[model samples]
Target: MAINEKSPSPAPAIVESEPATRCGSNTPGLAATSSNNGEKPIAHASLEERAGALAVPPPSGTTSSRYRWLVHVQFFACCWAMVVAGWNDGSTGPLLPRIQEVYGVNYTIVSLVWVFACVGFLTGAIANMFLEPRFGFGKTIFIGACFQFVGYAIESAALPFPAFVLGYAINGVGMALQDAQANGYVSNLPNSSTKMSFLHAAYGLGALASPLAATQFAQLPHWSFHFLISFGVALLDAIILAAVFRFKTHDECLAAIGQVRHLDEPSEKNDDSGSETEKSHFRKVMTLKETHLMAVFILVYVGVEVTVGGWTVTYVINERNGGPSSGYISTGFFGGLTLGRMGLIWANNKIGERKALVIYAALAIGLELVVWLVHSLVGDAIAVSFVGFFLGPMYPIAMNVCGRIIPPSLLTGSIGWIAGLGQAGSALFPFITGAISNKAGIESLQPIVVAMMAFTIGLWICVPRDKVRTASPSSSSPEGAGAIPPPPRPVVNV
Candidate 1:
């Protein structure tokens, strides 16, 4: 946290000084600066240094390298949540027959339970919009674990269908909270998207583990025991979260970096006379364009990504000739997801985030097509796993883009809303897959997957490059304005 200031020059006439209120700014919204304006430019380099400060820089050690132990602890907690929640979702298909015989519930009644999680997800996503801002990501995670643990406990005890549904609802709330908070927290970290891939892969790892656990437990007299295991995992997460309360994640570091960067910049004393005018413009522009568009982008991104992950496995097994063991094919899908995530860590470190995403997207669509065209189970499984590799980076990259676009003042709410909407998309598409598969046959799932990928690439084209890079006057100075920026290189820690 060091700020080195150079001599300050006279403030140049306003060239394109877009004034944005700080995130959580009590001040009115930001005014937009048109690049077309003819004002004299400020010192480009100095302004950029200042703007970068305004950005929450990636945390130095609170979440990386030397703080390895803390990272391990948080990763474990995150993995635990993912596994249990995913297991609840994944295991149900296999456990359905057993569950029906034991409870005497009809198929339609049982289907209601599957959809219940989405209801919970929607509720939780909305709840997080309020909680994340007030409590911060870590605290929100702790609270989520509590809800998940208790909710699972209730379900594990074998309550009535209504009670079971209630428990699932509660757990869905917990899932949404953790998913949004944890994903946001990780993406904000320096080189976090890669870590994000790993963290999510851990969930897949957990899901992979679940089938074996469920199969073993299937021998037991009661399915309640399987749920008890989920409860135990959630409880363990709570404990781990408590132990790591003192540690900071990527968000903390970014916040600190932003503060330092902002502090070193020259003050607004020179423009105080015109501050009111600038502020007025800022408000109008924010309302008219940036805010709303950013929201839409976020909502769409999340929905698409989740829909892919949630349904890909089912598509592989049900349509492509995966077999009775096909339910286990979801594991292959998740396994590819895990490997893809691991690979992203390196890719993010070597290439820049934008390029990484673009490349991954290309790979994803190609692999998806491979799965779609090839009816052989072997080819389908291979393609599905590869799809994970490409799909690995999308969620985190979209989040990082959101962080860059939305100012910090409304970051938590904006991020939460985007995430919630995305999950809502996640829920929508998966539910559609289930419904469609019921009537059209599972093989029809390929077209939807392909369509979603095409849609994602189209949206990605709309992402403004300014959102990805620093917005200092120098970066956007007239001379440099239209130049295509070079690819970003990964920053290395010494």
Candidate 2:
């Protein structure tokens, strides 16, 4: 396979002497420019040019110190946003009983919150496809935050049941945008596997802490008080995003992280082509077999994760005859999830993402069985936590695989679809559980989770294997000055 001879022109008018590949290597073409020492030969170069010069393993050293600092700050903001998302998702489990009591609703009625949220998730996912290209990552995230703020505000008011469910819908839209962008952004960074783990670990931390707060808040007359805390956090998240991103466009954000490559050349001939191009990319993403498999995989995975977190409190209280502190079981689950993400980085690497997920799924199935069969409250609680622990790493690992296999051009939209649709499971399965529990006992939760886990293993097996790329040590390092080696032709087995 031969590399393309023509490098795509940058947004600006500057021309490159040598054609470069997506992996940041110069292919054999024309004479090399003498100014290849991470310095621009042309003054007033485009942001794409600057990014090209800095290259892929992510620029480090004195020259990019400020850019590095900005990346760090931006990551912090992303993590904070994830925490808020986790808090929102995790809060519902502990508050479910209280919400039912206040509204005088049954299991099926209370589950409407998640159903409405699922609708919001689908809406947000579709909106993201159009929004990011037009509004840029910064504004897109801020818009999501604003939507979340509105949702939290509505929920905190403790409105009618119908209105309360509407809030979850709005909140779902906000979370979909942030989740897609944050996961896509981190996966492109250096040491992505490690960073992606930590980024999601922050989400786990938020999920862990929220139950503790929500359980206490459930004791109050106004159970909606828990959302007030989320309202404040959402406000803070919006502010941080606005300040850090400064409303920069998508290309500008890519330039900041040294990932600008193969961006669509801005056409003076047809200004409207940008939207058309986005549509084309989206169409291509839809046609790919990998995209569908991944979407279903994530959908099932998230469904199981959220179902456990959201319904565990009700399960404990009703089945185990537990006290008011039953919410702690939810906290224990997310705590194990957070610990697994942070602690299992080495294990993931040791076992590989594809094989490791199967093992994790199997372990989670066994744990779910323990939670179902065991009558002891303490024993069920411990099993639930371990179930969360094994299930924790699956999401990040899936995201990492998607980043590797998907083309850079389609990455953002593909991820938006994957994350957004995947989140539907978060609502879809939970809603199903509740509706079913309305007829069957809440003990049905374990069987549904176990079935999803088994189905997830099948989905994982169907996903395409990542293309193998070999990088020289110098190119792999942040500080090494050697030219990056050209990537070999992609070889797809089966």
Instruction: List per-prediction Cα lDDT, in the order shown.
Output: 0.56, 0.76
Clash pairs of candidate 2?
none
List where candidate 1 sits over 4 angstroms from the true fold. 1-111, 133-138, 187-194, 215-221, 246-323, 346-352, 355-359, 468-494
What tens-digit string does per-residue lDDT give for candidate 2 at 1-494? Answer: 22233333322222121122222211111111116567643222454453444332322344255555666887888898899888888899999899999999999999999999999999998888778766767788889999999999999999998999999999999999988778766765545678889999999999999999999999999789889999998999999989988776554554554433332222111236577856754576677666678999999999999999999889999999999999999999999999999999899999887888899999999989999998999999999999999999999999889877665545667788899998898999999999999999898888888888999998898888785221111134332222222322212111
Write down the TM-score for model 2.
0.83
Off by over 4 Å in 2: 1-61, 257-259, 263-274, 468-494
Residue-level lDDT for 238 in candidate 2: 95
Query: What is the lDDT for 487 in model 1?
Result: 20
How many clashes in candidate 2?
A: 0
- The whole-model C-alpha lDDT of candidate 1 against the native structure comes to 0.56
For lDDT, the strongest prediction is 2
Q: After superposition, how far is residue 394 of candidate 2 from its true place, in Å?
A: 0.4
